[model samples]
Target: MLSYSRVILSLFAAVLLAASCSDPTGAIIPDDHSLGWGLALADAVRDSEFPAGVLFMVSCIDVNDEGDPETAIPWQFYYAEVSDSTNVLIVMVQYIGTTNHIWEDSTSIPLGALPDYADAGPWVTAARDSLGSAYSDWEEYALVVKGNEYPEFPVVLNVAVLQFMSPDTTEQLSVILDSDNDNVLGIIQY
Candidate 1:
């Protein structure tokens, strides 16, 4: 027979053990799909006094066919732009298991604010058009290929050239984030 003190101690140990078994990384939490980055971006654009805007997102779910994230890695990239060339925003979200956290950062900068870079306009345009038509919603462009040179996605052979047309002027620009083979692509207009 166990003494009362020993039984109490055992219960305390069991509680501690259960707490230790809880998820440390919080990745298992389902995406609530609440009002997050997209809505915030629209508000930001409005505050900046911009006319219309467009939001582009590319995500690579690092899950195997079994839908187990533990078996793979995850990557997400986002881009938002106003009708004018004045403001462009970017966000990147990555999962780092070693730290047991999801890492993310965002910034908004003007198009000409960055230094000069190579013009892959033609390549990107051809690639985007090759998909037939640009849909206003996110769509999967490719599937994850295991043991390939570009495991995250395929090499981006085509680039997307987005054009924001307003009554006054038409702003055309190429966003640099690209996913080759295994990336999901989609655009949201506001």
Candidate 2:
């Protein structure tokens, strides 16, 4: 003996529940493109805010090269790893808006080509060759964190920022941070 309003409310609840169950996060974010190279042992120890054995990999993707000031968009990609003796938790910061953010695991993305570590000279030369003078500012960093860092639990944060593009779109990059411990090693463990 339910009223008309009660029946309608029940149906609405069931529909909402079904939708959430299908895709818990509401919308799915696209996978990032991985960089073939990971954190070097030397660089890890040098740059890591974490403990002795954390590894990190990072790269920028789908970059827009327009230099005009009026229609530029800026974005950053970040990776954070939290580990202990028993478990490891890794989070990928794909895109962050003014209030909300999206993140996933490190493995979900596919790998890109490896950067040449042996000779840093050639890599810079190649980037310059491709980019030319159309860019007002183009700087590349090696094993640096552009965002926040927490030394406790030996947390490791690796970040890259892509700035100034023609159409306003978010930028993405792949980064891995691992505790040098064998168990927590990322895809491209050093």
Candidate 3:
């Protein structure tokens, strides 16, 4: 049977997968909303990650902005064509919309101290789903950190990270990396 934490992660992931997309040009981290019209794209890339012609789209969703220390959530999306010739995966980080994360947290919880669960859900889905596939194939995977707890709160901002892949011999990537809250990095392919 699945543990409560696992179930929460699963449900959160599923819910996020369904409604995960932001403007990618909103507020900055909580308490730092003054950062201005865009969020920084945190990314890492390597050669042979995927084939050429791979397209990537990214978006971020705001979780809360009710009051002070507004927390902006990250919801990224990637779309691309899958092909045998594709052999390079480039991780491009893009800014998305702004969100208010305060709606989910209480007065005692610090915005920055918020658990990884808040930032992890959308990030994992975005990073893993960058290929526009609902899931990943054997050749690659996007390492994502699964959460154990699904906090009960409201979302103020919702972002979508869209990506495009180059299609060749492989089928169209149509899924994101689904995990079981193991905290293991999800793999990705080109």
Candidate 4:
């Protein structure tokens, strides 16, 4: 009983509904490489209108990609006001459905000392390559960028590749790198 135009409109509406139901937020494809890291950091700093001088540490955790060391992941930038070191500001950037979502919060406990603000792409690549075939066994990756708190090393890049053996047991490989020259300081397995 419906006209041709009405039938066509109804079918179109049905198709749209199906698509919306399938992917409500569209695809969540991450960026090509760790390029998102710099982009997100810049976006967060610009949008938040916060002074970059206070930034102390940058980190990303819970990364799951096994093959690509440069895979994009959410990054967190930590800043501490010079006068008020007791409270630290956290700027978190997450990519969702082709756009980035940036949010900020404050914490009482900071991660570490100041950051060297070095590019993490090269460090990640070197770390993964050093792992060789063992890289496949790690299900998660995490990296922290901060000044060396120890007197022994001037490390600024701390990358951890981990594989969970059981609920309480895990195997971890730690890659330490210097920010001054991007040199691999050490690789320890535990």
Best by TM-score: 4
- 10 residues in a row with least lDDT, candidate 2: 181-190
- Model 2 residue runs over 4 Å out of place are 1-38, 42-57, 60-106, 111-116, 119-121, 137-190
TM-score to native of every candidate shown:
0.25, 0.22, 0.19, 0.57
Give the clash count for model 3.
Answer: 72
Q: Report the alpha-carbon TM-score of model 4 versus the true structure.
A: 0.57
Q: What would the per-residue lDDT of candidate 2 be over residues 45-98, giving only the tens digit for each residue?
A: 323433432323333333322211111212222233423222212222233211
Off by over 4 Å in 3: 1-43, 46-48, 51-53, 63-72, 75-79, 82-190
Per-model tally of clashing residue pairs: 5, 6, 72, 0
Q: Model 3, range 77-99, lDDT digits (tens) per residue?
A: 23223332222222433222332
Residue 51's lDDT within candidate 1 is 31
Question: Could you tell me how far off, in angstroms, the CA of residue 92 lies in candidate 4 after the best superposition?
Answer: 1.1
**All models, RMSD in angstroms:** 16.1, 16.0, 23.1, 5.9
- Cand. 1 Cα-lDDT: 0.33
lDDT of 1 by residue, 50-132 (tens): 33434333333322222222223443323335334444343322233221112124333221111112222232343345434
Ranking by lDDT: 4, 1, 2, 3
Against the hidden true structure, what lDDT does model 4 obtain? 0.54
**Clashing residue pairs, backbone N/CA/C < 3 A, model 4:** none
